[model samples]
Target: MHWLVLIISGVFEAVWATALGKSEGFSRLGPSIIFAVTVIISMGGLAFAMRELPTGTAYAVWVGIGASGAVAYSMMTGAEAASIAKIVCIIAIVAGVVGLKLAS
Candidate 1:
């Protein structure tokens, strides 16, 4: 259950990150609101998960999910350049996150 929460928190990290980018420095009301709300939820989930998971591993997983999701979204939306290297690196991050989970 803690792992589930942690994974969800990581997903929200991506949600907030994407919303923040769309917020245009908090100028846009909708995206800004989305960013604020998701950030809180994401952090809350992270904190909850931290009660059971090791801090270092949890943080790494959280960051890995967020970064991987954000990059994938950017590429899919044409907001960022896509390349094989970028995809491979994102996969590596995900693999590392999974490896950590398995090792733990």
Candidate 2:
């Protein structure tokens, strides 16, 4: 399904984003490879999903997933602060993603 592909792409987007940060200007080898691969796969999946899903809706969803997942991963990995405000913002992003999907 297109939706499934979109969500999977979003997940890959998150992975690539986090990996990019860890890559440290591409100084790191492993994470850099992961970043490149996931980024390509994520974009490819997004393009495929766009064939059926509206561009705006799919983009918003993909961004929402990447943002939320990256923040969560950073917090869990102790790479970023985990504050109440951050959590609230992530929740808001989720709400917006859901609203867009429902309204579409």
Candidate 3:
């Protein structure tokens, strides 16, 4: 359950990140609200998950998920360029996250 929450929180981190970019320094109302809401949820879940998981493993996995999710979303939306190198790097991040889970 903690791991599940942690993973979901990681995805919310990506959502908040993307919404922040769209918020345009909080000038936009909709995305700004989205950012605010998701950020809270993300942080709360992380804090909760940290109670059971090792800090290092939890943090690394959270960051890995968020970073890869944001990059993947941007690539899909054409907001960022897609390249073989970038894809490989995202895959590496995912692999690391999985490795951490298995190690734990």
Superposition error at 6 for model 1 (Å): 0.5
Q: For each candidate, what TM-score against the reference?
A: 0.98, 0.97, 0.99
Model 2 local distance difference test score: 0.95
- The TM-score measured for candidate 1 stands at 0.98
Instruction: Order candidates by TM-score, high to low.
Output: 3, 1, 2
| Cα lDDT of model 3 by residue, 1-104, tens digit | 99999999999999999999999999999999999999999999999999999999999999899999999999999999999999999999999999999999
* Candidate 2, residue 28: how far the Cα is off, in Å: 1.1
Q: Write the per-residue lDDT of candidate 2 for residues 2-104, one digit (tens) a residue.
A: 9899989999999999999999999999999999999999999999999999999999999999989999999999999899999999999999988988898
Worst 10-residue lDDT window, candidate 1? 62-71
RMSD versus native structure for model 1: 0.5
lDDT of 1 by residue, 1-104 (tens): 99999999999999999999999999999999999999999999999999999999999999999999999999999999999999999999999999999999
- Indicate which candidate wins on TM-score: 3
Off by over 4 Å in 3: none
Clashes of each: 0, 0, 0
